[model samples]
Target: MQGRTLNFVTKSMVKTKRIPKQARAKARIAAILSATDALLRSSLPSNITTTAIAHTAKIPVGSVYQYFRDKNDILEQLYAEASKQVEELVLAEQSAVDPALGFDHINRTLLQCFWQTARSHPTFGALTRWANREHSFVEVTPGTDSSLARLIMRTFEITGINLPAARKEAVLRISVTVVSAVVDIAFEEDDADKAQTLIDELALLLSGYLA
Candidate 1:
């Protein structure tokens, strides 16, 4: 995850294909994405085929190509969309944070939002798995300067703690790394109680670190 996210922070992502203009064409494209999402829930991205997506979408294979270059292209778009959804979730939750309540309250609120969003998204775990396996180099959008990062920076800065620019970046990077590691582990556990425990510990760990 470290190498992959670092690559995202450093490199450019491949541009996707042309957008559909007409309503009918747009519907076809939407169907393709929806089919891809459904298929992804059951199979790894590498194992999914363009033909399979075409069949699932009930569109001609050539029509799928009309909107996407191939299966991987479809996956890339889906991955981008998924990341955007998660980013929005983070931003919305961050906006509701009450700064006067102190770092611990702010920390727990943000972490809970992230965990709940991840759990609610049926494809979140699958997307992470696919990303780790196939396109490790592809930069997930918003990069390292995500809304969550900005929120964290702002929270710490308001406390009147003077951190150098370099130090600020390092702190955000380590915090993101630590939280993500624990969240990833929580996602894989079958036991709901254990998953909640992992997330609780993550909140405790991050709150202490930031405090």
Candidate 2:
């Protein structure tokens, strides 16, 4: 009876402390990532650990484990969030409609959106810097599509490009890939003109594919 009572009390406490949903988990994760961003500017990703993140967030290291599997999992969640943020910006700002064809219109818009998003979320650079050189959070999901992929599909459809499902699928991943690469460059470029130049060049190349 005593052992059973102890187990019940422990389990109840654990349940009470559990994060409610993935959203709550993500919120805590975001707080941790923001702390990491600050720390990484002065240190490297490897130097930043669960203890560092929790200290930065002023939360207990033990509690952090409740949400993230580890530091890499935290980094991966940050990557996914960063990608989603950019994707949301593109989707929200889409205003062009072209059925006659050509990716030019969409490319310019996408570049502009990408620039704004990267600027708004400066930590994105640090996240990408860590994600690419070290641990990437990419996972293969069958029949699963990204928001950026859906945006690309919408653009292609608007342009009257009758792309097959496979190609349409490929285009989304391509757009995310290209936009992300530009982000890598944009973050390092201090000059606005230089950043705009890169955007224009990328937009032109993407447009040519449709034209």
Candidate 3:
């Protein structure tokens, strides 16, 4: 879990700039990010501009420039923050899971947390969709796949499963890929019932593989 969290934190740190030092600076940065998040919820990512962010944030355009190099910079920070929240959520669930109860329960808890996070943060889906386009603001990768694999290995370790060196990685990689696709489908669906059905199906699919 720490390994996966560190990967995302390191990746984000490399892309983020203009660290907030003072209280006002921190508040201003938060406002900028908040404004950017709101704009992303309603408008297309391509249509959003730094000037518009500044206007929404009620600050000068120069202030937005002070904290963020550009809109992409803001998007990068948003993604970074979202990654941290997800890592924290998974870790929190990890502590609550009893190894005796097994990975089925653990998987359900984690999946529920993931769905809740996405639902709570409207910008997460928007940023992800935007980041995949041809003129994407930020480079996207399969970072979540490795993160999921690491978390699964930790769970297996806790449960005293004698997973082989070669097969452990292979199983987890395939599990993460398939589960991620299913979750993506859930996120894309408009009907809440259908989305939840996808999540539940993912849980069952993972339990069959992991157990």
Clashing residue pair totals per candidate (backbone < 3 A): 0, 0, 0
- The TM-scores of all predictions, comma-separated, are 0.78, 0.65, 0.77
User: Model 1, stretches more than 4 Å misplaced?
Assistant: 1-14, 22-24, 41-47, 137-143, 157-162
lDDT of each: 0.68, 0.59, 0.69
**Candidate 1 worst ten-residue window by lDDT:** 2-11
TM-score winner: 1
Ordering by TM-score: 1, 3, 2
Pull out the clashing pairs in model 3.
none
Task: Write the residue-wise lDDT of candidate 3 on 20-123 in tens digits.
Answer: 88999999999998998889889977899999999999999999888778888888678667766766777788777788876777778878887777667767
The worst-scoring run of ten residues by lDDT in candidate 2 lies at: 1-10
Task: Give the per-residue lDDT digits (tens) of candidate 2, residues 15-81.
Answer: 2224547776767756776887677667766678888899998878986878666787666555556
Listed per candidate, the RMSD to the true structure in angstroms reads 3.8, 11.0, 4.2
lDDT of 1 by residue, 161-204 (tens): 45678777787877656665576567668788999999889889
Error of 2 at 14 (Å): 23
